[model samples]
Target: MKDIEVNELKERLDNNEEFVFIDVREEYEYEDDNLGAWNIPLAQLPYKLKELESHIDEEIVIHCRTGARSGNAKQFLENKGFKKVRNVLGGIVAYRNLEEEE
Candidate 1:
């Protein structure tokens, strides 16, 4: 699977590009901080797959506190036939670090 850097993801969001930015962390972790992502915890991903049916073929960027959960999520989506799935390397921690550097 492909991986996206934090800066690239930020640029896409800044440009208002259409893509699915999924937060795979639990609710509390998400409440701590998130990059303007859709609330879809990893636990609920299977049940919520239908909700994202339309985006199956779209660019999907999955993230969590670390990259672990999102990595699993990305694999799951790929197994289910998602065309373009990616994990944001190092997850939000990396993203936050990038933001701090800028």
Candidate 2:
């Protein structure tokens, strides 16, 4: 999976570029905080693959609580032939810190 820095993702969003940001954390974790990503818990990803079919050719960024789950999700999507997939290197925690710094 490609590694994307949180700052880069933030800049993309700020520029109004459209891309799919996926949060692979649990419902509670997602509710607590997210980078405005589409919430799809990792456990349900396989069954919900169809939901993201439209994004198969687009840039898709997957992230979880820390990054492990997102890595797995990235691999899954790659295996399934999703061309452009990225895993945020440090997840929301890192993004939050970067935001504060900026």
lDDT by candidate, in order shown: 0.90, 0.89
Every model's TM-score: 0.94, 0.93
Task: Report lDDT (Cα) of residue 11, candidate 2.
Answer: 93
Q: Give the poorly placed runs of model 1, Cα more than 4 Å off.
A: none
Writing each residue's lDDT as its tens digit, candidate 1 over 1-102 gives: 578988898899889998889999999998988778998999899999888898977899999887999999999999999979999888999888888998
* Per-residue lDDT over 57-79 for candidate 2, one digit per residue giving the tens place of the 0 to 100 score: 99999998778899999999999
**Best candidate per lDDT, number?**
1
lDDT of 1: 0.90
- Note the residue pairs that clash in candidate 2: none
Best candidate according to TM-score: 1
Count backbone clashes in candidate 2: 0
Error of 1 at 30 (Å): 0.9
Pairs that clash in candidate 1: none
